[model samples]
Each structure stands twice: as C-alpha cells, then as structure tokens.
Target: MGDLKILICVLIFSIKTVHSTKSKPHIVIIIADDLGWNDVGFHGSNQIPTPNMDALAYNGVILNRFYTLPQCTPSRAALLTGQYPMRYGYQGIPILAGENRFLPFQIPTLAKKLKELGYDTHLIGKWHLGQGYRNATPGAHGFDNHFGYWNGFMGYFNHEATGGNMVGLDMHHNDEPVWDTRGQYATDLITEKSEEVIKGHNESKPLFLIVSHLAVHTGKGGVDLEVKDIAENNKKFGYIQDERRRMYAGMTDELDKSVGDTIKALAEKRILDNTIIVFFSDNGAPTIGSALLDNTGSNWPLRGQKFTVFDGGVRTVAMIYSEQLQNKGTINNELIHITDLMPTLYYAAGGDVASLGKIDGINQWLTITKSEKSQRSEALINIDEARNVSALLTDGGRYKLINGSTVFSEVDGDFYGETGRDDSNPEYNTDDILHSSVNILLRGNLTQEKILNLRKQMELKSCRKSTIDHDSCRYNSVCLFDLFEDPCETTNIANKFPEVTERMKSKLEKYWSEVKVQRKGFLDPNANPVYYNNTWYPWLEDTRCHVGDLRTILLS
Candidate 1:
C-alpha cells in the first residue's frame, strides 16, 4: 500500500511539472509613441541618455529597419490585427467631432487572438486604436485588462485639457472602469503598472502585456520637465532650447529608469529567462517647437516630417530583448511593419497564428531568434493624400519611390516641397535656377506655362484616382534612389531607368488597390464615424498637419 501511494504521488507531481512547462512564454510589447528612429540611445543620440532602451539593444536583437504606419492610430490598428491598416478600412485616422474613428469592431485584434489561446492579455497606457463610444468598445476588441486614454494626445499635468485627462473613459479591468492611480511621474506610472501586471500574472499560464507608453508624444507646450533631478540640471539641459524637448527628455529619462525597474522586477520574480520584451516607436517625430527634439534627437538627413511618406515618417526604432532569443547585436534590414507584431508574438508564444488570414508582415521569428536574415524581402507603401505624396520602399533596405513631384514642387508645404528639382531650368541641377523655380512656383510666382509643364511631367505613367479627381494630376511621377547609395534621397535615377519605374508603379498600384478594398466604402452615410462603404474619417477636426497644435499637445 505504501509503494502504491508513492507511485501515485510521483505521477501527480510529474503531471503538474509537465503542465507548467507547456505553459507559453511570457510576452511583453512596449510601444513608444511618436519616437523618432534616432531618439533612443541605441540609435546614437547623445543629448538624452536612454540606458534602459540601450541595454535592450545591447543584449537582444536590435531591428534597425523595423517599419510602421506613418501615424499613430493606423499603426496601432496594423499592430493589433497583423493586417495592413487599409484592409480593415482604417487607412486614415478617422475623426468626427474631435473623436477619431477606430479600428472596425469585426476585425480580430492581437488581444482577442491571444486571449483565444488562453493567455491573459493586458494593455497599459495609450489605447488609440478605437474609442469606446457605446458601440465601438475598447474592451470588446481583445484585451482582458485595459487601462488608458482613448484619444491620441493628452495633457500630462492638466487633465482638463484632454477631456477627463488622466481618468479617461472606456477603460476596463475585466469590464470595470477602475481608477488606478500612481503618485510617480506619468512615464514612471506607466512602467510601474506594467511591473504590477507582470508580477501578478499566473505562474501556471504565460502572460502577454502591451506596455504602451505615452512618454514621447507631445503634451501641453514645452517639455513637461518637473522631475527633481531634471530641474537641478537645468543649465546642462538648457541646450535643448525648446522647453518641450527638455520635458520630453525628462520623460524619456524616467522612462529609461522605469525600464530598469521592470527588468529588476522580472529578475526578482525569476521570470526573466522565459519572457520576451520588445520596444518600438509608433512613428516619426514632429519637427516644430523644440529644436532639441528635432535638431539633436529626431531623424535628420531623412527628408519630410511625421505625416509625409518619406523615411522619417514611418521608419521606427525596434528592438527585441530576450535571454531566450538566440540573436544578439544583429541588425535585420529586411522589411517588417507594425502589422507583423501580432503574428510574430503569436508564434513566439507557441500559438498557431498561421491560421490567421492575410497578415501583411512576414514572420520575423527566425531573423529575431536565430540571427538569420529575412528569407523573403518585404516592402512598405506610405500615403499622405493631403500632402499629395506617396512613397514605396522595396523591403527595408535600398530603393524607394517618391511619387507626385509636381504637387510637392508646387503646393505641399515645406514638409516635402523641395524635390531637388530646379524648376527654372528643368534639365539642370542648379539650385539657383531649377530649385529656385520650384520655390517660386510653390510661392505662386511661376508662369502658367511653367505650372502646366510641371503638371504634365508629374502625371506621366503614374496611377490616377479618377478623371474628375483634381488630385489625380498629382498621382504618379516616380523617383527611384538606392537608400544605401543615398540615404539623404538626393539623386533620382528614375529618368535613366524607364523599365524600373514602370515595374515599381505597377507594383505600387496593385498594393494600393488591395488596401483600398479595406476602406469603409464612402463618407457620411448615417453620420457615425464609420460611414457608408466603411469609410471612417479622422477624430482630429482637421487632418491637416499642424505642427503648432502638435507641439502644444506635446507640451501639455
């Protein structure tokens, strides 16, 4: 009887151990809002110290060429669904009465997919994908525990500026709007919450945490630098002329400290070995207000700001730090985007995400885990209708196409107005005449003939919206440049290679057509954000890129 009892006890213990071992690895995704590719220490910024982010890069797989959508909501939508933003009809940041349109309710997000796999998913900080307005719900999507604001920007100190401010609406902790407060700074507060979630997770099951930080996004006016140490070092920090960058740097400093805290917590909990942590930015920086923000930290040499389709707009800082990962100090330049996150995390956590349909991103697991290069090259297409500009990158390496040079030359603001073309002498590269001509045309100083010729050349062989669409004239002039050859995008080889231009245009149009099918149909059918045919406009009143307003928000 004693021997039989021992055998049963041993058998039960073995079963429990096996079950625990089968549990998935803990996964955490930390997304920084509106951070430039050069903002963090890993990217070689000396103005602000980012020890935590730099540590991740040194110890893990640093993806130097990770790509994301040009803006926040679209990027979030893509990240959550593992699909291109357009596929779900959320190509633009849909807005109605200051409230933006969100990702469609029907799409299965990463939260939902992970939840289906029996992992507890939690989102801490910034939830901008969709607002919870009775019909459109944040909790309804997939996150088991959600705590954050619904809007894109908010005041770090003055909660009144952004509706209810810190205490936002549509927040849920298992279907309850629980007010969770922290006395520390906002960046620290966010990181603190992430640690709590990590430590409180069930030991028997794997965990998935989306630690979305609002640190880098703009707030009130100047930077929100109220930290004790930051104020003392005001002189040294004063080099950053804009109070916004100083405050932003303060926030970033705290954010780095918080990362260290989280790492410490993970170590204390003895789960560091099994957990995978990823850090990435939503988009590029806004080059206004704080010169320190733009001058020292932002992606320089890359033309165009946040809203434009240039490299500065969508190329982001991405790193995956995990002791379990085999790759370290390896840079994977193959094309990868925000949409790939869902499927990549799903696969990493031992779930079968192959069953998920039509994810635009390729699985970067091998590249990240084994330090192997990408098997299939991937490309990214970015569009800014208001700017009348479009760009396509062949994977994340070399070769880019910039379309609609005429509009860029004539009308678009300084953002992408300079096309390296001398409008005065079309055949010459003289900044005095040709470049000056472009400036004149943009300033409304050019003659009718000059404008007509510019329009004609810009429309050649490019895709058009429609015969009546006034913007169609701005549709399809292409400029090709090898990024490795010219990271500044100075030289245009399109004129020399007609065949390459045609091939790229065809490919670009095909991609656009496929994504267009994801549109919400037409605008304003029943007066909701999502109108007829699935078109959802932006939440901000005007979709126009306003650097001033953005700076004000960042400061707040």
Candidate 2:
C-alpha cells in the first residue's frame, strides 16, 4: 500500500511541471523614432553612450540586415497588419495633422489577434497611424489602454504641434486629450506610464506591450531643431563641442535610460525570464535639410539619407533579446522585413502561423534564435511614392536594382543647415570601432577576423561599370549595382547585366500590378465624410478648432 501511494504522488508532480513549461511568454516591443544606424553605443557610437542597450545587444541576437520602409507611417502600418503597406494604400507618405487618413477599423491588427488569444495589449507613446477619428483610435484597434500623442511629432515640453498650418494640442490618454501633462517631457512621461503598466500587469495572463518612443526626433516650434532634454543632462555631454550634437546625445541618453527602466520593471515583477523583448528604429534617420528643421541624425558608411531609396535610407537598427534565444550574442545576417514581426510574435505565443491568411510577413523566430539560414532567397522590394523611387535587392543584399531619378548623395555640414560642427558629415566609417566593441562585449567569443570575414562574404564582384546620370534614371529606368563590390553605389552596371535587370524589372512590374488591384477597393479618406459627435463633416476638415464654438454644424 505504501509503494502504490508513492507512485501516485510522483505522477501528479510530473503533470504539473509539464503544464508550467507550456505557459505563453510575454512580448515587449520597444521602437525608437528617427534613431540613426550609428546612434546607439552598440553600433560603435562614442558620441552617445547607450550602456543599457549595449548590454541587451550583447545578451541577445543582433539582426544585421533588417529592413523597413523609408518613412514612419508605412513602417508602423506594415508592422501592425503583417502585410505590405501598399496593399492598403499606405505607401511611404506620412499622415499629416488634420488629414483624414487613418488605419481602418476593418483591418485586423496584431494587437487584436493577440487579445483574442487572451493577452493584455497596451501602447505607450507615439501612434502616428491615425488621429481625430473615432474608429481609428488605439482602443478600437485592440489595445486595452493607450497613453500618448496621435500626430507624427509635437513640442517635447508643451506637447503641441506648432508647425505649418498644424497648431494644436496632440497628447492623449485613451480617447481624450490629456491637458494636465503639459509641463512634463514626453519621453519621461512615456517611461513612467510604461513602468506603471509593467508593474500592474495581471499574473494570470501574458502581456503584450508596445512602447513607441519619441526621442532623437526634432521638436516643433523651435528655430534650431530642439531636443528637449533636462538641463542637468546637457552637462553630461560637455566634452562634445557641437551644441546640436550634444543635445542629440542627451536625448539618446534619456532613451537608453528608458530601456533600462523597462527591463528593471520586468525583473521586479519576476517575469523577466519569461519575456521576449524587441528593439528597433521605425525607419532610417532624416539627415537632409528638408524636414524636422535639419535633423542631425547619421547613417554612417552608407549612401544617402532619409527621403531616398538608397541603402542607408531603408536599412535600420534592429535586435531581439530573450532568455529563450538558443544562440545569444550572435549576429544573424538574414534578410528580414518589418512585416515579419507579427507572424513571428504570434507563433511565439503558441498561435498557428498557417491560420493567418494573405500575410507578407514570415515567421523568423527560429531562423533568428538558432542562427539558421533564411528560407527566403527571392528579392525584396522597397518602394517610396513620395520620392518616385523603387529598389529590389537580390542574392541576399549582394546586388541591388534601383529604379528612380534620385542619385546617391552624402550628407555634409550644409545638410544640417549649421556650420562650425566637426561631426556634421553623416557618413563616417566606423567598421573598426564596431568590430572591436562587438568583440569586447561578447567576451572575445566573436573574433575581429571573423567579423571582417562575415562582411567580406556579403560582397560580390562587379561585371562592368557605367556612369549613372540623374536624369537618365527615371521611374521606368533601371540601374544595377553589385552591392558587395560597391556599397556606396558609385557605379551602375545595368548594361552588363541585362538579363538580371530585365528579370528584376519584370518582378517589380508584377508586384506593382497586384498592389494596384488591392488598393482600388481600399477606403478613400478624401471621399468619405467623417462623423463626429452626431455631425457629419468633410473628411479633410479640422473640426477640433471649432469645438464648443458657434461655428459648429449639427447634422441632426
């Protein structure tokens, strides 16, 4: 009788262990706005110290070949839906203030899908996909709670967008404007709210938190593009002589602190070991003098800056940190797109990827964690409607085909609209610094020679060289470059590789045709009238200005 009782007790213990191991892991995605490729310390930036971010990179896997749209709206839209932005007519153009454009409620977002699987969804920070529309709000998109601004950017201290014809308050908590948060800095407020959410998370179910930070981007209503950092923080960068660069560095420091705070909160809650954290920039940095008052962000060692289809404009900083990673402190050079995160995270939460229909994204969790080669070998397409440019990269980023009129241009002192700054040029080569830093961070697990060899393996030989004329290359024109041999895109080789060029052009044509069909059925924001407070008004109209005024029109 005693032996039989002991056998029953052992059987019960084994069953409980198996159930505990099957619990779903928490997901946390942290995104930075307009963060440059060379901005973080892990990427070999001595100007800005990102110790916390550096630690995470060393403890996880770095995605070396991550790609995104050239702008914010398209990137965010693709990330949430796991589909190409062009499918929904959200190309590369940004959604401006007072515009009727927004993510439609009919579309299913990653948040909505995860919430159905019993996860708490929360968003803390910038939500630039939509504003002023009731159905386009974050709560309507499957987020249980949201605390941030709706527009692209606003004053860091005042929380107001006072640029061009866009002058109004933009901060919000859920659906209502948050007026009491006027004096606080936007970055700190986002951090505080994120900590609160992490601490108050329910233990019974997993959590899905998206912390989209508005840092390293210029503030509105300032003569010289301002970055709102505390006065004491400015003193920390006295060694940097350039005032603008110093201010930018201060902003980056605050962002790094926020990352550390979030990780610390997870640890305090005792859920750090069961959480998967992802960090990436929304798009490449805008270094040209066109927008945001001459942004001083850098995309070093690459050609072109933001607002272009060059490699520097689309390739960005990305990484994944988790205790579940099989090969930590390694670099995976697979070609992964921004849209892949949805399917990847969904699969991580024990959801079936095959059940998702018509998604452009693929599940890359296994490839990233195990350092396995990517199953996708076809070319990846990047389109920018605002610039009339398109590019196709084949042979795993070894070759590039550009179809546009824009030429490769480097950013210098004139780009920043400022003089007397030594670090004004945005194309400094930091390969040696990056290799040394990676070796040290990984405790010599990755040798310097191995890093150099990995880069060399990505290069290819050029067959011929041709001079590329800015006017000669238009929307239909084709230009080819062996990216491995000419990373700067100095020579065009379309004449030598006619077969390859024609094949890539045919692929682009087919893709464009398909997207046009998909876009035709999409809702037109300009045609439909928006209903607000029991009144119908033109979609492009800014009704917030006439709120509580006699000029208001009642539809009833």
Please report the candidate that would top lDDT against the real structure.
2
Give one digit per residue, the lDDT tens place, for model 1 in 1-556: 5574355334433432222444577788888877766556445345565655655554566676677776777788888888776665565642322243556787878888888888888888877764434335457787777765555654454421132112222223443333344233456666777888877877677788888877677653323334536565565456565665665667666666666666655554556666788888887665543421231236543544565456666777788876557655455556677777788888877778677776776677877788676754646555544445566777446777778532233322123211212232123222222222112211223333443343243221122112222232234556776666655455567777777667777877776666553233232222232221111222233432222343234335
**Runs of candidate 2 exceeding 4 Å displacement:** 1-19, 222-234, 379-381, 384-387, 405-476, 517-556
lDDT of 2: 0.68
Error of 1 at 479 (Å): 2.5
RMSD of each: 16.7, 9.1
lDDT (C-alpha) at residue 463 in model 1: 20
Model 1, which residues run further than 4 Å from truth? Answer: 1-22, 94-100, 132-135, 160-184, 221-230, 233-236, 239-242, 289-297, 384-388, 404-477, 517-556
Estimate the TM-score of every prediction.
0.72, 0.80
Q: Worst lDDT window (10 residues) for model 2? A: 412-421
Cα lDDT tens digits, model 2, 411-477, are: 3211111221146333222343333322222222444454444334422223223443434345556
lDDT of each: 0.57, 0.68
Q: Give me candidate 2's TM-score against the actual structure.
A: 0.80
Clashes of each: 34, 1
What is the clash tally of candidate 1? 34
